[model samples]
Target: MHVLRKAILAAACTAGLAAATTPALAQTTLRAVMHSDLKILDPIWTTAYIVRNHGYMIYDTLLAQDEKGVVQPQMVEKYETAPDNKSYTFTLRDGLLWHDGQPVTSEDCIASIKRWAIKDSLGQKMMTFVDSIAAVDAKTFTIKLKEPTGLVLLGLSKPSSNVPFMMPKRVAETDPNKQIKDFTGSGPFVFARDEWKPGDKTVYVKFDKYKPRPEPPSGLAGGKVAKLDRVEWRAISDAQQALNALSKGEIDFVEQPSHDLLGTLKKDPNVDIVASPMLKAQYVFRPNTLHKPFDNPKIRQALWYAFNQEDFLMATVGDENYIQPCKALFICDTPLATTKGMDALLTSNAKKAQELLKDAGYDGTPVVLMHSTDLKALTNLAPVAKSLMEKAGFKVDMQSMDWQTLVARRAKKDPPDAGGWNAFLTAWVTADVMNPVSTAYVNAACDKASFGWPCDAQLEKLRDDFARETDPAKQKAIAEAVQLRVIEYTPEIPLGEYVQPAAMRKNVKGFVIAPVPVFWNMEITK
Candidate 1:
């Protein structure tokens, strides 16, 4: 690993030297080192941030959230909800065309929504209330609800996880479980499918045919103005090498620099580091309920008291300024945020945890914890988790792999020895978890639940009630109840929250300040 890194730095230094003498290219291009390699392309199939970023590069959404968290039309020119809130209507904007030159139609949007509903927790919940999603015309579609539903707009305009990225009808018709082969989209950038080499590089060109909205770009909504002619995503796994490349002008941006290296990057005059204006992301520790030890709620709850949030936060972020100990299932500072049952769990009582583990009949089986080593943010998580579990009198099997491999493996249902896992740690944009309506991790539906598949009938009912309840105070009350239930059942562990800042060259202007790091409206200059 050290030798490979040295070779990369040597090549980067050589390229930097060449760039210093050579004049800027005729066409503008932004070379970026994203958080990880673009292994998955279908954003609906997986909630991986790499794929979510890739989705933004090539696809357009019917609606999007702005910096203020307001939902605005993107593909939809105009939309209206019924007085009774039973039906909603949307009209497609003019000049929306797929990269292949096919016109964007309402049927395509309907199909995309249908495919998304299969795996997305919120989508599945929203669909239960939806009577039908039918096209009124080529440019218009209407969603008729079985009853009065309040989550329609929020559901369609959700900012993350199964993002409602509009695709061509054929591509949208692909099996929800399977990846799509088509890459056609009506977004501001056209994905260069031919140039895509999974682990090395992924390229995108400006969509000349895309027409920008009249409004100024805000968050993921409004005008998606492509300021650069081309964008290149280079996979540079090593943090030090990525920083070296950024400093040498070999790369235009680093999506996520290592937290420990932020001081060095900030000292560089040519580099500009910026944090997302959105809320800080939360670290989630999910355990497989189908497996041994963790299947017992008592054992799961014991981990809550054993695993110290501060330890995990310090290990993962290393900077106290950018992190906070938040025990809420709905991210801290959000409307649904609560500390109802976190008092005992967040205390970090190893003695109580051990007592609970003993009472739960923990059989001393090695807990298979999947660890993703490639991601700098996640690399230190497993070690911290392992230490805590061991201290709580449990054997742990720390299995290491890349983020993409971990993502794929977490979906398996086999026993630990047969390839399944006990637990893993990951982070979510605060927006994704701020409410039960959009939070997949909070869904307690048995086989149909998110990754870990923790089943709790009462928790599921509370979530459903929270979704249908129209009163804000009632919803908050329900959220507090849900948080308490989650704590008691122990589906997952909240390991605090932290902000991840991106580093870029000084000349890369017009970068979006949204939660998702978008390349649109960003220009690269010499």
Candidate 2:
């Protein structure tokens, strides 16, 4: 009996040792609530931030910007620029593979850049100087310019919406006017399209085959290591419910929490509020220049005269600490910032606005204004605009809809009463509007411009000059000229500027500070 007991005790000790050495098989999932529901998956189709964030998850860029806004190589292992700056050669890094197990080649990138250039504002400007973009070999490509210009690398390294996300040649060949059906990408995560629920949840799983860079992670650059096995973006539209979820540890992150409820989130010992200076944004009121009364630049200018930046700022962001009354079209406190032609327009005078309307042959046409109900920061903008415009002697038709629906409806060129909109309230990251060429709303390329379709030959000329100029002082002068033109044409109204912060559980770490929120290089600890 003693020998049998000794054998059993020895077996139990061996079992315990084996258990201690085994690895855990459970998958780690980081659940998050993004700023908006991701209805559009094609980043090239729209400039929506949600779609751009989705693009970052599944697509990789050839070049990226670091924390300091310096452009760096991402997919490209090395690159060389000619002395004349008319040609650039790029070589792709090794170990890069598509989500479908295909190798990433130079031909794929060339096709992707061509497709992106067709829709993006910066891309269009860069293409104006490009003579040819051809692949030299399976892994090498070159961009030959018509003349020397500095926009080649800058356009490719653009970090905001309409980012140059690389895809397979087959998918990239899709028409720019239509969305692509294929969702294959070469980024750190593989999109789980089979599990995507448009208004509920979107899932992404780490791509085991992805080879991260050896360098340390930086803002949208360097190594993008997916630390979690799975990531889920839950669509919780109600801000209070999202905050409650964060407080109770039900959700790991909230991309944009309501300013009023921020105090409630701060009271939670388990939550951490992260406010990054890079996340500041500018609110805009865009008018459709294809239809009246907004089709008349004079009418558009009248709205500007009636607008009060402080009223919009107060209504959207109640917390005085987070809002700013800015008049510069190119964001205040940045280079090229100016209020050149803004003094006469942004007066907030109802009588002055009425006088202008009368001078323009006052037609009491109802302005079809779109109100996005789902967005917390934008919900109050249309209401305030309606109140202000009505007081200025303009009939306003306030239409309500979710943000995604508005995003789609705004693209229609039909008459306002015929399934079209006259104007809408939206916001852009400060990074997106820093310059005349990069700003989408300010592009005056007629039919080729953004949804507003504000066509002005002088404005386009000024933007082209800004893009071609290399001198800082000359560029600033060109930008101010562009701003003055924008004020006169009134393509879009600059409501104000504000800083938005993200909230997450205390266990979430390594969140990268960038103009746009990214998921890689982050992990959640239990």
Candidate 3:
């Protein structure tokens, strides 16, 4: 046994790989649960870096953000930025092949880029500034920009194909909405059939014919190559059911299940637990100047007093970990996190809430509250507003729906008004939405996007300028102003930031949970 162990160690050293380099697949597979399926396999529809980030496990990007946040090369073997920084030339590496054994080409990437930009069918706003992309050849491509937007590479290195992983223009532009599930791409895995049993599992098998990545490849920023033969993602929604499987050795891991179950799971010797609270933002949206009650900024401000966010998150999600009483549009970690100290000054006083309601001459009409599938977590939330609003001389009723339905409901102008809902509960994710302006546009009920609740135009203009302005001092000044505007002129109430947790068996390995789907560069090994 010692001799065999010695031989294996020697082999690993010679290959410059620890046993970790090629660890065996877990005997118990990696399984998980999400509130809903990440249904769209198409990377273009949503700016879903999380989904596209998962695609990096199978696909490739020209520049990839490493574990250390450096933009390292993955696919492009050699590249140079133009003196103006608006145009970039990339030379594709030789010999990279798709899983189907076709050579990976710049043409593939260029096609993907064109389809995303010029093609209106994709329906996303990314690539709005690109002038065009020129395919120099099978191995070379040039990108031209319309503006000197900062974070451009960060935008392109993005996990979403909207940013990187160009598809062959021919294939992508062919009827954008058509389902091309017969997955064929130059990645570690080919598109295997997506099989979901009615209430059982969803699995994606590795394409056995797939080739390993070239030492250096175009477009790929030298990202980590896939190390496993297959990756299987099973949707197990119930935290307890998923954790039970983990405990029974049916699955390899799970993330934070429940605080209540922590002690019992901790007692097991095989278990490894890390009390990592997820990074998330908890906030609210309401009609604004564009809508009736929200048309008055004072009323928006008045509602702020009605909400006890400190208690809301604790009782709703049962996670006091989200201690931020952030009443601004941006979460605390945001560069644009409220700095004017408005949240610090504001108190959740019901008396104050009533006074403001009376000042607004609120007639105690039934106000419809909108929420999504977070009903279980909403336990702490729904009732808190009833008496406060009633005391303020308003009657309120809470309405709930599934998350997907809620999201769809929000897209149409004045959803709460048209749909007969008065208030909406939602959370803005931290992705491209890293600043206050962007956050406000997406979540502020004041925006006409919330059905004519006129949002603060100053904030919107600041966000637009923030995206375009090259000056740092100027940008910071705009951000500071925007934060105060959100406080004084609220389109929505900033409640608390939150993360959804899942239960896993104690022995699960490589579960790096983020607010987004993070099934990349990780695996279960036992």
The candidate that achieves the highest TM-score relative to the unseen native structure: 2
Better structure of 1 and 3 per lDDT: 1
Q: Write one digit per residue (lDDT tens) for candidate 2, span 67-164.
A: 88899999999999999889999999999988766799999999999999999988988899999999999999999999877888888999998899
**Mind sharing the TM-score for model 3?**
0.73
Alpha carbon lDDT at 361, candidate 3: 74
Q: Candidate 2: minimum summed lDDT over ten consecutive residues — where?
A: 17-26
Q: What is the lDDT of residue 122 in candidate 1?
A: 86
Residue lDDT tens for model 3, 1-526: 4344335433432342222112243222345544443444555533333345445545555666543335665666777788887877888767676544567788787776555443221112235456777888889988777876554455555532344565544456655434444344555543333343424544443433344444432223333444443445555656566567667776655543554455577676666665333335465545425445555667667776666666666665654553456655556665556547564333656688777777887665556666554334443355655545565556766676654455445444553446745666545454434554334344232422333244455755655566667777787777777767666766556676676455555444444434344443445555
The runs of at least 3 residues in candidate 2 whose Cα sits more than 4 Å from the true structure, single-residue gaps closed, are 1-26
**Per-prediction count of colliding residue pairs?**
0, 0, 40
C-alpha lDDT score of every prediction, in listed order: 0.85, 0.88, 0.53
**Alpha-carbon lDDT of model 1:** 0.85
Which prediction has the highest lDDT against the true structure? 2
The superposed Cα distance between candidate 3 and the true structure at residue 271, in angstroms, equals 2.8
